[model samples]
Structures are given as C-alpha cells and as structure tokens.
Target: MSTEKIKDARRMVHWPGHMETDYIYTLGIAGEKFFTEMKNSGRIFAAKCKRCGFIYLPPRIYCERCFEKLTEWINVGTKGEVFTYTVAYVDVDSSKLKEPTIYAYIKFDGAHGGLIHKLGEVKHEDVQIGMPVEAVFKPLAERKANINDIKYFKPV
Candidate 1:
C-alpha cells in the first residue's frame, strides 16, 4: 500500500468519534412509600389523582393534569399492550449495547398512559403495535427502588 493510503487507513482506524464520554449520570426522586413498596413488597404502584381520576405509573407524588397532590395509590396490572416502541442499538448511557434492545411504552390495562421498559423474549422483527406483554419482576431480593425492578416485559 502507498504511504499516503496507509496514513488514511490509520486515520479511519483512530477516528475521534469512536471514543465516548463516561461521565453521564441520572438523578431523580422516588417517593418514600412508592420506593419502599417496590423494594419490600414487589408491587407496581401508581399515584392516582383523587379529584381527576388520573393515574401516574412509575408513581408520582402529584397529578400533572390538574396539578394536585395525588392521594391514592393503585396497584397496576402486570399485563399491558405495546403503545409504541423503538429498537435501540444503544444502552441507557448512550454506549452501544451488545444486543439490539427494544424499548417500548407499554400501556397497562385501565391506565391512562404507558410506562417505558425493555421488551424481551421477542425478536426485534416481531415487535409490533398492540402486542400483548406481561411484566416480569426481578426476584424479591433483587428488587430496587428503580424502574428496573420490573426487569422487562415479555410476551405473555
């Protein structure tokens, strides 16, 4: 190969864009009882707007619609349908994930909006709108206050 061509190849091999940053972080609040239940009871709870009858999954302390403090807690069903989804080639931190992952908004029955989670046990090509799925929880001991406690949704 010519020396000029060798340098061009080396430049492509050492592309700057290939190097990624690792300082990213996520911060959020988990209400006291809301998180405690997930870690200790393995329950999926949502805050309900007592006045407006709106429910917030992944639980919120207040209602967004009416801007009222949520006063009721509802146990959401495990079964839900895919509202929409996208096949992600990257992980949460924007690093390329090894396996292609399906991220979806699942609308649980009787809920107003869907919660986001991974769709598993289904091929990337098989994921479609309105597909039925059920939440698969992590082991009780493995439960955390985070949304990951549900692990992922699988075809039911």
Candidate 2:
C-alpha cells in the first residue's frame, strides 16, 4: 500500500477531456419490479407496509417507519397531483433549451412518496400545485423497463 501524498499543485496529474468509465447499474429489487409492472401493464405500483400501513410510491423493499420487509404491492394507479413544480430554461449541460421544460413532484392518490418527472402537454404557466395529472406510458414495444417507460406526466 502506498501512502505517498501529492502536496505540490504542479505534481498532480490532470486528465484531459472527461474521465469515462464503463459500468453496469441495476435499480435493485423493488425498483425493478415497479418499473417492470408499469412498462408491461401501464399500471403503477406502491409498496404497503402491513405493519404500519404506510404506502411507498416507488415501492421500497423495506418500510422506513417499521422496518418491515415490504412485499405487498398495491396498484396506486396513474392518477396524481402536482405537489410542486419548476420550469427549467436550460438543459442538464446548462445550455439554453429550445423550449422550457416543466418538472413536477407528483404525489400519487394514497402514497407517502411520489416521483419527480417531467410534465408534458401543458404550459409551464398553467402548471399549478394540486393540479391533477396522470402517467403517459410509451408503446409496449418501445418500453425498456425503466422510468422513461412513462414518457412524462400529462395534465389530466
């Protein structure tokens, strides 16, 4: 094991461009199930803690409150309301966007936690707190068992 420390600023090697690495990431048990169900059936799910009866929208493997292993899945449906939202004028790279994007934190009908996704088919000025919305899933063949399966939430 080497314990050498680079104290000189000039001694530190700098890599050009970007550090690129290849890796595989999985969403784990709960997330995979949730997305799979939605991608295949167009139905969203929530995990219910039988001990405390607290439902999680993203479906956790364990309950946050009681630490119970959450295996009971409930159909939370696609209906929800915008808890809050923001209009972004720039992309992830901070470049000016062609059109502003509306992102909203949508809370499902009876779930404790919800998802943060882009809202479509509505103008940013029209998006309001407590505005009803629903998931708009992509065509079955085009889905990849991920959050993108639901293209975006659209105002109901």
Candidate 3:
C-alpha cells in the first residue's frame, strides 16, 4: 500500500517469540502396514517392484526407481549382516552413557535396502563389517508397533 503503512507492517512482522502449537503426525499407507506387521507378527517387510525387481526395506507404496505403485510385499526376515557400524559413548543429551552402545547398518539377506539399529549381545570391539546378525524382537506384550519393537540386532 502506502510507504508509511509498508514500513509499519515490516516493523510489526519483525517481532517474534516462540511459536507454540499442538500437532499430530500421520504415517502414510506404507508405514502403517510396515509397522503393523512388526507389531503384530514380528516380521520385517520389504516392498518389491514387480517390474524392476527392486526391493525396498522400510517398504514404500511406490517404487523409487520405476515410479510404479508397489503392491507386492516380501518378508525380508530378521536375519541380516552388519554392513557398517559405530560405537556411541554418549547419549543424545551428550552425557556419557553407562556403557558404549554399538550401532550398525544391517542389510537383510537378498534385500535392496536395510535398517540402521542398535547392536546388542556382543562387545563393540568384536563388531565387524559383514558380521551376521539377527533382529531380536521385544515381547509381544511390550511391542508398540514401531521400530523399537525390535530391541536390537545381535550377532548370530
């Protein structure tokens, strides 16, 4: 509008403080099914593109490469191999943890994608790339339909 009004509006807009609001996040179709299987059956799933034979862990509704809607799901199972690993000596808060935690990128047998999760039941010093591992699921009663349902991967 006018120059004076524009200047006043700019001054008004410049004032800022913490913006607070309540919100909920929804997991779309693919995530819902994936977590449901983990919670209900303790199974890991992968989405397969029938046209391209590409499999995606943390399964998606559409193929990333072919862009085709993916409807075929395969049970990738709990077995995997450690693709990579790291040791965390601190917590998320940067506080030193009681013990170091081992984390690994575990690739499922015959699957294209894999999951990054914590490793347990083995010493961090013993962890190796290509180490065979298997997912350990929390008890059925403790499952909350999320990735944490898998407690961790352990050496097989």
Note the Cα lDDT for every prediction shown: 0.80, 0.91, 0.91
Tens digits of per-residue lDDT for model 1 on 1-156? 544545355565464557666883433353667667776887667778888998887677777788898767888868889999999998778999899989999998766776899998899899989999998888988886667878899988
Pairs that collide, model 1: none
Instruction: Give me the displacement of residue 7 in model 2, in angstroms.
Output: 24
Backbone-clash count (model 2)? 0
Q: Candidate 2: worst 10 consecutive residues by lDDT?
A: 9-18
Candidate 3 Cα deviation (angstroms), residue 106: 0.4
Off by over 4 Å in 3: 1-23
Query: TM-score of every model?
Result: 0.73, 0.87, 0.84
Q: Model 2 residue 30 lDDT?
A: 94
Candidate number with greatest TM-score: 2
Report RMSD for candidate 1: 5.9
Off by over 4 Å in 2: 1-17
Candidate 1 wrongly placed segments (more than 4 Å)? 1-30, 91-96
Cα-based lDDT at residue 78, candidate 3:
91
